[model samples]
Target chain A: MAFDYDKYLRPGKLPHIWCPGCGHGIAMKGLIRAIDACGLEKNNTAIVSGIGCASRLPGYVDFNTLHTAHGRAAAFATGVKMAKPEMNVIVVGGDGDGTAIGGNHFIHACRRNIDMTYVIFNNSIYGMTGGQFSPCTPTGAKASTTVYGNPDPTFDISKLAIGAGATFVARTTAFHATQIDKLIAEGIKHKGMAVIEVLDDCPTTYGRRNKFRSVVDMMKRLKDIAVPVAAASKMTAEQLEGKVLTGVLYKEEKPEYTQQYAKVIAKAQGA
Target chain B: MSSPRVEVIERYCKGCSICVEFCPTKVLEMDAFLVKVAKPEACIACMQCELRCPDFAIKVFKD
Candidate 1:
């Protein structure tokens, strides 16, 4: 059968609410392609999102969607999955919503190795909240909240997820549309918790203040800074210092949380 | 091969014109405070306009 993406999109919501030159739209298309590639049944899919520009994704998608509170996408997604184990649950949110206020939940979710895919749209700023400093905001970067420059170090989200026990973790940029779609598709197929961090641009909030001439300039920067993981591994720390690594950073097989919980429940029932 | 085509939903457009300003190929134009696809042939199907519009008013499709 032929694949049609427009079927999944809400007709009236054609124009998304992200600022022009923002990277979220590219990420969204990547996600749609991934979902289509995986052949996931739209009726069985459930998307949960937190408050942010990225969180608005659930509303636009045709599947079962929930727009939860800020920084609680994972928590709400966990509940959705646990309640209906058959549902293919995916959590979507921005860097601040996923790595800042939702940081703790993110770690525990990874550690639990739940059967869910977490897609983080990391634009390095709190776009929805007026360009505040996000946990992933790079050091010395300027934001509306950080007039001088962001003094805090950025969180390497993929690395953090791998370290926290996610079964699969990948990193890609909005510029690498095909790669992003492939990685997201792989994440969805993984048995245990999977995390994909998509490096995106926030032109209005993050770009204007940081001196990005335009959206194209920001995309070019992403293309230049991104280094394939295979190539990066062969380089020295100094060589890789300022470069961003893209591709699957880690993957492993582990018993999923829901499956383990089912065993425990069976034991109790027998007892 | 030809490039991608961009469609702007004028009703949803808040006249941000970011699409016109940010398109790398200069595929979009601002006419009367509204964005119009001036150079659809230059689009790369990047979906940058769709992603960047705060109003969610744009879509990129192949020709």
Candidate 2:
């Protein structure tokens, strides 16, 4: 079935701001497909995002979208979910917005295990800010901030989400469209907090600094390095050194925060 | 299933060739200014072309 993207997108927001070869659009479409598959009513869904290239997604998506401050998307989305516990709240952000400036909120949201979905477009650089090295930028990759090479270590977002108590977590690249759509839908369906880290491409900024010959080359590299979680389990640590692991990394049943909060309210009311 | 029918909306195509390069069946090709269905019979209806097009220009329909 073909997805009616026009129905989910803002009518006048055609021709987005992304560069010609950017993979953010692919991730956006994957998100739309996921939302459609989950059967969530557009009016009842809230999409929150911070400041950055990937964060601009909410501006184009037709939902109860909130273009929040630089690093406060998760915090804002938390409030949105708390107020309307039945609404589906999803936070969209880039690596810089989600992990660098918003790192604290990101961790707390995961630890809280709130009923929301967080999708991180891990393009590894501050694309909108002239290609500065971001928290998810590879250690040796070059960026505007690191002309020679990035010396700082990168954050494994999926692993971080797992360690921080996210009820559901998954990772997929922009090149894996089907997998991206399926995983995102699964994340939306999960009861508690779900963090899906999508490895997207910033061809104009990250690609230029990192010496990717073309968008196709960068996408091919992403495809080559990604290994499914099931296949990765059998491989030794040395063999899996540089491979990107995809599929659902972890999932567990836990009490959602809002439900617990209701309990507190009940106790206070002497119910 | 029969061969998939590929349609390229020229106005939306940016001539990126992402679809041509990523097509697993090698069914698409890049013309001078836009994409063309060089071998429609080879299309597998994977929808990779439609999903990966940054410009939302191409679409594939399976018969």
Candidate 3:
């Protein structure tokens, strides 16, 4: 059977705003497949996103969604989880929104170990904002703001999540379309904060500026630079150079924030 | 089950050619700016075109 994506998508939302060959669509499809695999109730799931190209994803999906202010998806998602405590909260945003503008909120949410999933589409540049160099942009990458190439170092988003206390951290590229959904589904099933960083492509903004001739070139770049975690472990450091590790990098059991808070409430009520 | 039917929803397709280019089998091709099924008999149901398609234009139906 052909996967009927129309079931999860809303009416008249087809022809999304993303440009041709933008990897966001592939990532979104992965997300839809993951959501379907999880069998989450449509009404019980809340998809939250901050302002960016990737942020627009929630609008197309049939779910309780919130398109919040710039870099505030994590903060808003945290509130949603604290209030309902039962609803599944998922946050999606681009690298700039997650790591630059919303960096503090993102880290804090991870630190709190909230029972939510955050999927960061790290395309390396702020595509919606016209090719601004984001925190995940590789050094010497060209962006509209960085005509001479970016001088700043990049953030390893999965590592950042792990350091900030997220219980699950995974990474995959758009080229690994199937892996994206598997990781996301695992994150949704996890009890604590789970972050999945998907390395995507921005053909119109990031690609054109960075000398990637076409979308295929960008996709090829993602494919070439990715090394699976199992294979990466056996590769020498020199062989692993310039390649990012894909698959679940870190996972652990932790006391989820919601459960911890519930205990506090019970104790306060003398139960 | 027979070889899967590969369909391209033309309206939703942005003519990116990612699916046509990435199909493991030579089952797809470009028709002007849009994509079409060039060699349906060659399709192996790998679903790579459908999965990697940024446009959600491709679908493979297995019997």
Full-model lDDT, candidate 1: 0.86
Q: Where does model 3 exceed 4 Å of error?
A: none
How many Å off is the CA of A28 in candidate 1? 0.8
**Highest DockQ against the true fold, candidate:** 3
- Model 1 lDDT at residue A256: 97
2 or 3, which is superior by DockQ? 3
lDDT (10s digit) by residue, model 2, range A1-271:
2666888998777678888778888999999999999999988999999999989999998999999999999999999999999999999999999999999999999999999999999999999989999989999999999999999988999989999999999999998988888999999999999999999888888998788998899898889989999999899999998998999999999999999999999999999
TM-score of each: 0.86, 0.95, 0.97
Residue-by-residue lDDT tens digits, candidate 2, B1-63: 666688887867777789989899899887896788899888888887888997777877777
List DockQ for all candidates: 0.21, 0.56, 0.75
Encode model 3's per-residue lDDT on A50-147: one tens digit a residue: 99999999999999999999999999999999999999999999999999999999999999999999999999988987888899989998999999
* lDDT score, candidate 1, position A211: 94
Instruction: Report the C-alpha displacement of residue A257, candidate 2, in angstroms.
Output: 0.5
Worst 10 residues of 1 chain A by lDDT: A1-10
- Residue A200 deviation, candidate 3, in Å? 0.6
* Evaluation by DockQ, superior candidate among 1 and 3: 3
